[model samples]
Every structure is written in C-alpha cells, then in structure tokens.
Target: MTAVVEQPPAQPKVKAGGGERGLIDLVLRFREAGILGALVVLVAVTTVINPRFLSAQGVEDIFLNASILALLAVGQTLVVVTRNIDLSVGSVVGLVAFVVGDFVSGTQHGVLVAVALGVAIGAACGLVNGLLVSFCGVPALVVTLGTLYVIQGLNHYIAHGEQISAAEVPGAILSLGNGDLLGIPYLPLISVAVMLAVGYYLRSYSSGREFYAIGSSPEAARLAGIPIRRRVLTAYLAAGVLAGLAGTLWLARFGTVVADPARGWELDVVAAVVVGGVAIVGGVGTVYGAALGALLITTIGSVLVVLKINPFWQEAIVGLLLLLAISADRLVALRLARVLRKRNVRHG
Candidate 1:
C-alpha cells in the first residue's frame, strides 16, 4: 500500500501586452518622464525668449550658478526618496563654509587643510543627524529641524558677529571657485560628476536598487530581507557628505563666509528635488532630473532679473511651480493606482 501522489501542472507565464496602452502604462509608472518633458519645454522657451541663453558664456554662468544648488538638490532627493527630509542642510552649508573660511584665514592653515577641515565638520554634523534620526527612531523632519536651530546657533556663536572677507582667502581656493575648464566652471563640472556617479549607483547597483525598493514599500522591502535601517542611514550620510562638499564649494566661490550664508536654501533644494520628480512619499527620482530642476529654478531667477520683474516674483513663481509639480505627482499616482487596481482585478 505504498501509493504515490500526483503533482499539479506548472502554470504558464503571462506575457505582458505590447501597444500604445502599454507605453502609457510605463510612462505613468514613472512620473519622471513627464517632468523631463516639462524641463525640455522650459529650456526651449527660455532659449526662444533670449537666444543669448544658449551662448557659451551665458550657459556657463547658468551652470556655475546652479552647481551648488544642484549638489544640494541631489542630497535632498536622496532623503526625500527615502520618505524623509533634512531641513538642516542650509545651516550645515553655512556652518561648514564659515569654518573653512576661518581655517583658511587662520595663520596655521592652507587651502587643502581648510577644505579638509570643512568637509570633516560637515560629515560630523551629518553623522549626528543620521544617528538621531535612524538610531533614536525620531522623525527626520523633527530631528533635522532641531539640528537646524542648533547648527545655526553654533554658527552665530563661532562667527561672533565677525565675517571672513574675500581678501583673506587664498588665491588657489578662490581660483577653485571661479576658474573654468574648457569653458565650463569647475564647480558645475564637479556637480555633473557627482550627479552621474549617484545616478549610476541608484540605477545599476544592487544596494542602490535596494534603496528604491525600500522607498517604494518599506514593509515589503523588509520582508524581502532588505536592510532598511542601514540603507536609510547610508542615504543620510551621503546627503551629509554632499552638504559638506557644497560648503567647500560655497567657500571657494564666495571667498567670504557669514553665519547665515545659505539661510533658507533648504526650501529651494527641497523644491528642486520635488520638482525633479522625486516623490515626497518616496520611491522615484533621478539626479539628472534634480539637476535639471535646479537649472530651471536658477534660470527662472535669471529671467526675472532680465525681464525686470520684481525679485519677489521669483519666489512666487517657485512656489507656483512646486505646487504644480506636486499636483502632477498626485495625478500620476492616482492614475497608476487605478491601473494597478484594474490589472489586479483582471488577474484575480
């Protein structure tokens, strides 16, 4: 009476449909495609309005001006993609810039040493932020908000109503800030390199893909054995390093540092990241889009000046653009959800 049981047949894999609807479905799944289109339109319109916008010198100026902001936006994109935010980057930038200026102006320090000190200080501050948020289990917004005040206060205390002037900074460092390579500024070139590195990592590496997975659905990611906490801490750490790098660049460019050098810049950085198609709730974005967003915002500011529009209008325009971006994000999310629901229903 040794009887054998029969096994069921294997189910066939269902091939995905191929057509315009499929293409639309793909686009809806990634909201970045739409933002990319918008960025192209913005560039075209700006170039049309002022052909000078495409001039070599003008293009270099735009890239140079957008460089630091693009760096900050990339960091902001990482945090936002993790469903978190860091409000302390502006203060971090100011503090690090001031520190580097102080060191460079001091009798004992040189350009390289000053840059190293500033970067180290920035990393320390970011480490504190990461620890507070990741280990203490505090909300990132709350922790960074507190750190913002703390860091700003530290900056004021250290500065003690003093400012470092451009005259005191070394010529070499100043050159770093102002010099161009083959018609492109060094800072913008560095920013592009960073964007490319980060973009490649997030798109191609396993650990990088894990970040997207975690952002897309933390619970599912956890169940799938992803190291969620470590990944988040790593994201914050990367952000902090970039913030430090930006501080160094700011120091080089301005050749002067004040306690409030980049005050309120976090808003612009966050806005750029959001406008670049990084979801506030997490999961989607690219450094290229973030850079484009930075360029767009910077261009709008320049256009305002060129058109003789009030500077206040620049801020207003940024606000409107952010609102529009958020609205578009929500609409796309809704469409994707509806499509997913229909697909699930049909499959079930």
Candidate 2:
C-alpha cells in the first residue's frame, strides 16, 4: 500500500457580517450609506404626499436642477475627503458662468472656443487656490474664503451691472445645457457620468486609497510615502474643473449669466457634501452619496413649494436634518473610539 500524505486543511476565509449589525456597520464604515438612506426616505415621502412627484417631467426637473449643485458637491466631496474645503466654488461658478456668457454673446468667439476658455479660466482659479494651500501652506478654508471675494469682485467688475440675455446666447451652447439624450436631460446625464467616473476612481485606484489614508491620518500617510502635497493639489484642480463644468451648465439652463449668479451656493455644496456622510474631520464619504444628498436637498425645496409649507419652515427643516446628520456622525465616532479602547484593553 502506498503511503499518501494528507493534504493540509483548507483555511477558512473570513466572512463579512450581515443583518441589522451589518447595516449599522455599513453606515459606520461608509457614512455615505446613511445619506443615501435619507435620500430614499425623502423621495418616498414626497411621492406619497404628491403622486405627481413621480411624473417624468417632475423627475427630470428635479434632476436637472440638482445637476449644477451635484457637480459642485462632487468637487467638495473630494476636498472634504482629504480634510480640506473649498469655499470659493460659488464664486468660481459665478465667474465662469459670466465668462462663458460673455464669450458666447460676443461677435468674436464661437461656442467651442467660449466653452474652452470658460473651463480654462476655472482651472486657473483652482490652481491658484491649490498653490496657496498646498505650496504656501495656507489653511484651505482661509485661502478659499479670500478667493471667494476676489472672484466675486472680478465678476462684478467685468459685468458692470449688465446681464447676458437669452437672445445673445448661441443655439449650440443652449442645446448643450437644455437638451436631452435618450430621454435623460443633458445636464443631469453629464452629472451622472461625472459622478460615476469620479466615484470609480476614488473607490478603485491606489491614489484614491491614498487620499482616504491621508484624510484618516495625515502623519501615517506621510510615513507611508504618500505624496500628500501632490494629492491635495490635484484635488483642488479637479474641483476647479468641475466648478467650470457646472458654470457652463448653469449658463445653458438659465439662458443668461449675471455678476452674482449662484451666490451663496458654496454653503449648499458644503451642506450636500457633509450631509452625504463625508466627515467634517475628513477621510470618509462617497460621490454617489453626495449626489444623493444634492437630490434630497433639491427635492426638499420643491416639495416644500408644492406642499405650500411656509418658506421660513423650509430653512428650519433643513437645519434640523443637518443637525441630525451631525449627531449621527458624532455617535459613530464615539462608538468607534469605544471599540478601539476595548480592543486595546483586551490586548493589554
């Protein structure tokens, strides 16, 4: 009889947990899930309250309206994930919108050239912000806040109290903003495509993981040889580009641009990013969640109008939701701290 060696026992793979604990773990591990849940609830409630809310036209309008904010929110998500913020997005949007409008309305420029110029202008602004924050080591919040004023001032001076009219806008440019493809509005479709691309990159790429690492612990990320400066700079650049794109969409949708278009929009972008579950402290969120947050906020405004709720109450409701989101974040952080402490004690 031949002696046969017994094969080594197979190693058991660790399985992730499931059920309510799993759901809680999911939310804690990825805060975006909570924002997504809130979005679902908001949609369901609105649909129940007004069955017409589910109509195709209504859906399209909601998405189209949300697209501009969603684009800015995507950039905000990237910056916030790296424990940074950009307070100049609103101004960037306004300035870029005006630039694009001016170009298109001028006798000298074509639609393509105008669009290119608009995007480049936005990118340049972002680069300046990045240089100040990353190279000069200025705080991001301060740098962006200053840029906010600078850009807004420039916009006002350039416009000189004038607004571009719909009659002056090019047909091609207008179509790009207001037209639809395969039944989906162009603006929303563009936003969806961008969100998907950015989301994938953040979730699937090594550099993206580095962003999360930096946000989670800057010191550790540095020790691990991650290029923190480069990543941060790149984040700002992406933000500028997205802001430009949003500005373009805005011009098309509104069929004009004024000096102060999208004023106070930075707060809306920040709120969407935070509400989508990106921790204020940094290193935890998803673009999809942020987009959903934008949708929810936009829907809330529309729903309020439809329900005939007092305009003042809309702000109050939004404030309450924001408060709840912050509270949830704190609870998760505390629980995580307790878990780590218990584990340390056990190890000791």
lDDT by candidate, in order shown: 0.81, 0.83
Candidate 1's displacement at residue 78, Å, is: 1.5
For all predicted structures, in order, the TM-scores are 0.88, 0.88
On lDDT, the leading prediction is 2
Please provide, for model 2 over 1-348, each residue's C-alpha lDDT reduced to its tens digit, 9 standing for 90 to 100.
Answer: 999999977543222224423544477446665566766887789889888887888888888899999999998888888899999999999998888888778454555776687779879988999889988999999999999999999999999999998788888888878788987788988899999999999878988877777887888777677889999998999999899888888888988778979998898788888787777788777888788778878888878877788877767766777787778778887876676667668877
**Once superposed on the true structure, which residue ranges of model 1 sit more than 4 Å away at CA?**
1-55, 106-111
Model 2 residue 147 lDDT score = 96
